[model samples]
Target: MGMRLWKDMQQIVGAGFTHDTGLPTWFEVAKATFLQETYQKWLLYKDDCVKMIETELVPQGGLFCNRTFDRYACWPDTPADSMVNISCPFYLPWFDKVSQGVVRRSCGPTGIWDEDDNGQVWRDKSQCEDELEVTAQELWLKQLMVSFRMLYTIGYSLSLSTLTMALIILLSFRKLHCTRNYIHANFFLSFILRAVSVIVKDTMLERHWGREIVKHSDVSDMLSHQAAIGCRIAQVMMQYCVLANHHWCFGEALYLYYVLIASVFIDNNKLLPYICVGWGMPVLFVVPWVVMKLLKENKECWAFNENMNYWWIIRCPILFASLINFMIFLRVIKVILSKLRASSNQRGYPDYKLRLAKATLTLIPLFGIHELIFIFATDEQTTGLLRYIKVFFTLFLNSFQGFIVAVLYCYANKEVRSELKRKSHNWRTEAVLMCCGQ
Candidate 1:
């Protein structure tokens, strides 16, 4: 099939050559010829099928009476007609079947057709008898969809929740809203923007609006490309925000470690500069990339060219950032361990709780490790289970970070724990008061 397609492509190109442009002209001519030929063939096929049904199979009583025959005849006609008009026959058969009311029943109360009798003909209960028993390929696709949904939902929820929490803490608990929380608040704002962008992109893709917008546009192709480039710039900014936030977390950890272990040697005030650098560096890295993207023709936002050496643009900083985070984490661990050892003579060790905290800290590196797997596995060449695994792990791990931080830090911190307890007590007290009044 591949070789035949290649030969057909070559023949198409060979037939369209002009004297002036030579090979390049021939290539362009060939591409146009191939598209035209393909379209014509699709139209011919549809016409043949439609002619067959209308002439041979259509009942004299009309198509609507006998549901079975009517469905059979109408199925091919609808798709065939649509394909003929659109000049895209690839989806004709599928759409025809779907449009003809050949629904696959489900096992639900509506018997898979639903209350409105609107059943999806693509994959019915028979094909996917037991969803759990689905083929690995099917499961992988389903899992990918699930992962996408999970990331979209979790990212959006966390962005909103975190931002709200940060704002409340900053405004209400002013004394508790220190530098780290201030940085976190700004990061959450950026995260909210990122989440909104993701939701918009996903919604557009789901509705096919993105493609429709392009198809229906009257703008020149070059102008369309320029607009795409601008969107890409915005996308890079979102990525920068995420990376910078991770770096900021590392800086926070480092500052905390220094204050605990090296307070006598280092000025605590100096840590503020490190925090500023962590946040500012990502902007510096992204500005040039955004400018270059604006100047370049936009083809795709995420697809990378094998011939282009753009991998380093993301990989280098990610590697450096991850390394720095690891180093900071290690420093914290070393200091904590040293303090625990030195204070052995003071009182009870709090061994169990301390062990648990250390274990949690150790798990932080897993985030970066899984992210690396995601980075390497998501390339043009990746396929099958590996690709799905990478996607699932990446989405799950990245999202898990926010939850982990919330659980470990918020639960462990005396102040946050107290605040949450107080809030819960207040809610209960309000409920009791309302009941008594009633």
Candidate 2:
């Protein structure tokens, strides 16, 4: 049994041993003695080893077993690797919630302590120092934030490209410059800017990828300090664009309602007021928000405040716009149905209603109705499947807002399609004429 134990121990540590393998430490002898229960004894020895690592491995001491022992101080097996509160003795300030001063070094597959890139065994002190990686939930949340940013980056890029094309198409055609199209164009422009701002914000936050927390009392403060002025500008622009997007959609709904339901006093051609409300009104909300945040919070940037009352500067306007637009939508539907019924064309009502439904669905992103659903979409009570569903669904809908707007308003618009066809036909005709002349 003794010979077998010796051979087994030799096999495990032999490759790392030097010519001067020296006598085994008391910890190693303890480990060798309880060979039948090597696992438990090693764990106890590991704990004891740490307790006396400085004394045991001193040059004058006789505890050295092998050169491998020089690098690795033995550590006990943790019940859960993820929950281990790893600390570093080299650093000061006892990390909060670490439960005493010691760090949790991982017990590796070889039943030895993990080593650093330099071959020096060390615990990941960052895991304790950085609060972001402290808990499983927090780590997952951090990853989810990254995923959200990635999703937003891709989605908004598509939206930005499409929106720019949409603007070009609208501006290229003078005929499509009526109140509704103008409002749509304004909405597109707002979202385009919003997309750009969000992209910039994400870029500035790229350093947070490695689980390092950006320390600040607030997100606005973090942005202001960590990032350049462009980040703050982008954050402010996002706020303005978000508000402009909402207001412009409201303007669109109102214009549609006036044209369809109450057009007697409404001059469709005089849309300067609508344009002002769409483009200019957002400044009212954004300026005060910036000023207040600067004065009161010394915020991270012009980022959203957690308080609903504080956010009331932007939220109240957006919410009011959404409510008003929804009301206009319902009123428009009622008027359309009534007109059709009075004309004795009940058969056409279903098709008209279906079209209206599609129109309403498309407008949901524009008017910010989808945002209301997000209020209840928090992962507070969620776990596992539900949490994933809530996060993914929210991200898909929220991040892809600009894409959805582009698809519905620009790519799918009848006027845009007709304009494209007309341009293509004229181009072909000009080409043919030039060929004939040649």
Best by lDDT: 2
Error of 1 at 146 (Å): 3.7
Model 1, range 151-234, lDDT digits (tens) per residue?
Answer: 647755774575556455544654556655555455444445545554444332222212211221211232245444544544
Taking all chains together, each candidate's TM-score versus the true structure is 0.56, 0.62
376-413 per-residue lDDT for model 2 (tens digits): 44433566667766666665775688788888888887
Backbone clash count, each prediction separately:
1, 6
Local distance difference test, per candidate? Answer: 0.47, 0.58
**Which RMSD values do the candidates have, in order?**
15.3, 15.2
TM-score of 1: 0.56
Candidate 2 runs further than 4 Å off:
1-99, 102-147, 207-230, 302-308, 340-356, 375-394
